[model samples]
Target: MISTTVAAVVTRFAPSPTGQLHAGHAFSAIRAHDFARERGGRFLLRIEDIDPGRSRAVFVKGIEDDLRWLGLGWDGEVVHQSARFEAYRGALGALGSAGLLYPCFCTRADIAQAASAPHGPEGLFYPGTCRALDPAVRERRMESEPHAWRIAMDKAVEQTGRLHWHDEETGEVTADPLRFGDVVLARKDAPASYHLAVTVDDAWQRVTDVVRGADLFEATHIHRLLQALLGLPTPRYHHHPLLTDAGGERLAKRRGSESLANLRENGADPAALAEALRRGEMPAL
Candidate 1:
């Protein structure tokens, strides 16, 4: 169990090894690392390599190298999600036994083309099409078809009652997991979804503070709900502003943002870059 003493502050920086670390990643890491170090707290590093098809071993090494280049070191050995499949499976089993999980066979295209589906922060949310399937049919489908597992949002909310979480930026916020409809807990291609894995990992590691970009603010509602369901302690959150380009678009790997390695190769001083990031100075990328 995590030390709950008022002085025991624990934070983490978890990034997927799908690509090189960019300026935005550096900013978030700096914030998380500083928040912990400044307070004499423990800061951890977790590599979220749950997606087998996209995650690469070389990229993981690049992440470590980039963090070191930025002068942000973490406490303890690094935790990798790919190596914790059994733990994730156990979490899914717990939710399944509680009747909170149901098989979701809907593909991304199916959800996108559904005219009735409502839009949310992350685009069109699942419409709970498979939540009402007959137990016999669901069992039969589970036997032969690949399916993701989604939480029964309404049922889960009822079980947990009204839930809320403390955010460093927004203050106390009520958790409305239903906005996500029935969010996936486990994916067909991965052992667990981000929602499930993160909640479980934070609890198991006893993380007391969660520091990440503001883009994930809404996702916290679902996470708070999951914590309540799994009897996990809620961590205080600090959703810092995202780093954007000169054109006002958020820096992203998909957009081919300038990476830390590129900056290093270009002769950018790591210490100077870290200072600029701390001062909120925009990168020339």
Candidate 2:
């Protein structure tokens, strides 16, 4: 059993630098900071810039500006995911050596077509096209192809008797791989997926707790599996409620609604903004 009274709860605010910060982002950042401050712990800021195509320096600067404007302070220098590709590669190589990583060659169209044929999720549930290749065939493919990397769930399940984690807010958590199946570890284009990047970053930073929006509750399973596979300590998760718009849709930076920048432009008070989000008020975008 994990200890309840954390000696030092290290939390983090990891935001992708692909877009601007919105009310939801502010709420989560403040909540994480407050949680760490309340426990006399460390609050970290990490840049989730794995998506090199979309992540930009301007957006990163925007994030720092926004967080500072919200009166949030972090403990150390901000960590960027793009600079940690070698670490991700090392982890992937470990998984590969353990026979727990496999290359996926299925394209978006192929996955989509497969999914449509099976009437499943938007994309193919990874038909395991490259999973069962013979050693020689796999070697030949690896020699000639560029493919995404996927965790071999069967091997992971065999290694770890059961997958489970403790959420700080939700309590005891468990997941069955039979339901979620294998998840991608790295894309061919994007070296690190969100799950892989987050798990590695948390472990690297010695984060003891994670506080984010409730929308990612299901992703806890993926993180749990990654932690077990990588032999990294699991942090307590606290998933807070999401801030939504008046239309009841979740606010997104890409959608250009209820962004902190816009709120500030409209002369919205930071204190009042925080209170409004806490009270679930749809801020005027």
Candidate 3:
């Protein structure tokens, strides 16, 4: 029965299966979960397993186990990016039909050597090298070599015009899609790039509030643009501060920091560990 009460608040905790969960992940997950529960909302869990090169089954299992140990549970079945390839492909096609997508044949080295290439928030922004390629040339190269599909940022922005999204942490923010240059939508090895997949999935899943780390604050600008392009509703964002080490370095998996699994194995109490994490008292180092 549709109670017709106020719509339920929806949140999500999306983690990639690249490495074992760490202190930072614990804090983020607990925060998202608690935020939703406190408001009688539903919290979702998404497995960002799009990057086949780095994602692993073991890490996926470890994420669930660590979250459980921290006393966090999500509503509904977990959504896996690997299982949503067709949807991503459709989104790409939609953008392509709108003349907002193009193929790029340049490798990372080629972009680095391009004398006129401009730098943006994400490393060297892609110069529109293939954006003006002869159709025959592009077709030939695409059939013979690897390439990534990138959004025609200028064209896409022109279509959307001036746009803005609200962020709970910073209030209304103007969209700056061009700041990322012509961001990739799909890659050679992967059907969809991180930007494409995330925007498509979030809208599909009806995520109301995005709660994640502050490191992704800049990326939100691109996300706002994608939402406008795809004709999807925008959700509020909350970029929380990251958990840091004793030396003030941020805790991260790639840095080889201790994992939640190791902490559990070392006799860390789940309830107590959760409390300490909430209070920012854990990880004395």
Highest lDDT, which number? 1
Global local distance difference test of model 2: 0.80
Candidate 3 positional error at 63, Å: 0.4
TM-score of each: 0.96, 0.91, 0.95
**Model 1, 34: alpha-carbon shift in Å?**
0.6
Candidate 3 lDDT score relative to the true structure? 0.88
Positional deviation of residue 149's Cα in model 1 after best superposition, in angstroms: 0.5
Global CA lDDT of candidate 1, please?
Answer: 0.91
Taking the tens digit of each residue's C-alpha lDDT, what string does model 1 give over 76-185? 99999999999999989989999898999999999988888989766888888898799899999999999999899999999999998999999999998878888889
Error of 2 at 252 (Å): 1.7
Residues 69-142, candidate 2, lDDT per residue (tens digit)? 77888998999999999998888887888988888877778766664334322224666667878878878887
For residues 1-285, could you state the per-residue lDDT of candidate 3 as single tens digits?
Answer: 112133778899999999899888998898889889999999999999999989999999999999988889999999999999999998889899999988998889999999988889988988899998999898988888898999999999999999988877888898888888999989978889888899888888888889899998889888888888777778889998888888888988889989999988988888987888788665452
